[model samples]
Target: MSSSAAPAAPSAIPSEVFEPPVLAEVVRSGFVEGHHRGSLVVLAADGSVELALGDPAAPVFPRSANKPMQAAAVLRAGLDLAGERLALAAASHSGEAFHLELVHTMLAEHGLTADDLRTPPDLPLDPAEAEAYLAAGRVRERITMNCSGKHAAMLAACALNGWDRAGYLDPAHPLQQLVHQVVEEAAGETVTAVGTDGCGAPLMAISLVGLARAFRGFVLAEPGTAERRVADAMRAHPAYVAGTRRPDTWLMRELPGTLSKMGAEAVQAVALADGRALAFKVDDGATRALGPVLARTLRLLGIDAPVVDRIGHAPLLGGAGEVGEIRATF
Candidate 1:
């Protein structure tokens, strides 16, 4: 419980995060070229893995992909947020007007101020918004940070539990302990190692299997339960859950009832209505590979989605128009 608890030993970076035989390739004109290595896991209805690439057992921090479970915990800790509010709590939202306003509203509703947020203030995650802010000479504020919604939820949980709002980001805080409990239960896996997220909250070392399992549980939870509520809310307001142009938002909008969340460092988790799941991490941490990889995995599940074209391929630029593409090699 001490703040001085030794920092976790840095993890050995995996030699390859993706499963065998290169999952994607960069081809220039007529020549075959560079490729990405990563891992993928597809779960059967019975919870057995149907396919695996690379080493799904290797641990990953899962980044924002873990937000739904954290949102579930906040709900468990006492907060009745629903619809867009609930979705935003599990969001890595682009700092759009709706998203920023909602974060402000949540803080105001809980009698907390932006000063109470422990997450560091940063410019908008959306490139356009960031550009606009810079153009207007606007300064960074906690409410406009991508993780503001999640931070607001954390503060609300503190208010509900009568815990110190100022220390809510501490790993040993009652709020975080509740989060750990929810994560373990949802993942059906033991959590050991820890790391700090970009947002400054404690992150757990969990394998792709555990991450997949967590999302599987979320999709299949009892209709009226907190887990199901989070899933439903995210599905209902996919736009708020991510942004106007994000894969999470697109997938949820185009494929209703699918639970989708992406994390930092190329981590992604997607679950079907029946609780089956796929979770993966791109070895090189290439965000470019995520769309193609997830699209391929979904194809294996018998879905022929059109969004694949929108997100899957990474184009190679050349003088004479399009000269190359990043195609899935697997």
Candidate 2:
């Protein structure tokens, strides 16, 4: 076939791709209202498949769940980051006062400014924080965006490596290339696709199985390694990775040795100290269903904690009263 040959016709394509199963159901006043379909994979401590629902092998965008891998890539590029700053570098922060302060400090230390960030300006990710920010008459700013820390860290990596800072987010840039390599190495699979993320960074698509495996690798890696450092920092500073009100923060804070991160559009990945890990994406992109699914999955893993109940508390209301809830089905 010639290099510039026409693409295969639609009729030539096979309909063999798997369809995801219903993972959660919405109930209102004892009536099944709707369903959220998705794919999920749980890997046991020994890296074997423990439980799988739907088509976990299909490639999907992992979104901000890929941050830890990207942070490890930045570390490999010789950008020195540790503790909370390292956590922030891998964060989808809530844009609280502390989160904003650290982002400022990181930029200052790197001889960069908020203007260097490529993330589109937006309000805080946390509802309470966003409300307060709006009440203060503040408009959107790049530094206040959830991915600002990651962008600042990217700029720092470029500065340290003498790479072009202006084009840091470009996939062809040295930093993004390194990130792509690291992601593939960690996931043990080639990226199925490349797209621009909400933060304007290059996004890689991989299967749920690969995503779970990558997170497991981070937790199980040796100390002093870039992967382990990113995992440790995120576990140690859960608030920076998410925020006080987030399930990622709550899970990591309440369950020691656990690393958790959630992405936009109802994507989540979590790893335990013992090497058990899981990743999932709700096909409908319904964020409200994530907590219910996660809590159920944790319970299936034999985890019974108060925090699980807290996370699973997704209630439907009827005129200031709880009517029903979103419950996990699988």
Candidate 3:
């Protein structure tokens, strides 16, 4: 269930090589200007495949979509995180003031500091926040990195276990090893590859279907279980999981009991209260296509709410006026 060899490279085959279907189209002035090719999968409440496109079986890095599972791993490794703390542990936060405040609090509670984080210094993840930061002449700092909260939680877990904090990001570390195990178990599949994530942590590769299954497992796990706790914390504190302007937070806020997470490179995984789940990735990594595609996918499952409209509201512009839009193809 683990590998020591170098992680295999993701399939770099051209989108047309396997005839992967178009998931979305960029329409400008009512003309189809471009297409986004990718893979997607949807699972019914019973966990059976209801829809699939492209090669859903192919392995892909789910990126930060794997945070909830990683947070569960931290809990399993003996971190007593809960509520907003647990939610932030599983967040790709927008680096808003509130998120930074809690991150600082978490580090202080655990006798850690910004220096303990291994995430590279970066500006806030939210555009508005980044703009304000630059306007104020603030330079990038490790604590402002979007992944700092997760790193703080990791350091706390390391402290709890009395493990070497310096090597916490190593793939072979005890905590990450446990994370690998939990990921495999929750996804119900063997991790086919490994790599370094944007946050400089080990990344495990699993199929789109496996990613969907993992999200569903989290929502449906027995109460008080690590998976359930992570799901609950994230759902209850949607803002902590992402931020005020993020779709993950929006979707969870509008739809109770829904679990939602989007990762870098246009990866998204979601599960409903009834256990219906889905995962998708844009082959070209065009995040602009993610919204329309995701909204259409939810429609197939009979989910049509105002939030869907909000999520799918990616309008194209022309000289400060409405032009057209990016929309789902199928």
Pairwise TM-score winner, candidates 1 and 3: 3
Clashes of each: 6, 0, 0
> To one decimal, what is the Cα RMSD in angstroms of model 3 from the true structure?
8.0
Q: What TM-score fits each model?
A: 0.91, 0.95, 0.95
Cα lDDT of candidate 2 equals 0.95
Q: Give the TM-score of candidate 3.
A: 0.95
Candidate 3 lDDT tens digits, 1-330: 896999989978776546789999999998998999999999999999999999999999999999998999999998999999999999999999999999999999989999999999999999999999999999999999988889999999999999999999999999999999999999999999999999899999999999999999999999999999999999999999999999999999999999999999999999999999999999999999889999999888899899999899889999999899999999
Please report, as a residue range, the 10-residue window in candidate 1 with the lowest summed lDDT: 16-25
Greater TM-score among 1 and 2 belongs to: 2
- Candidate 1 lDDT tens digits, 213-281: 989989988898999999999999998998997889988888878999999888999998876799998
Off by over 4 Å in 1: 1-21
Each model's lDDT comes to: 0.88, 0.95, 0.95
Candidate 2: stretches off by over 4 Å: 1-18
lDDT of 2 at 197: 98
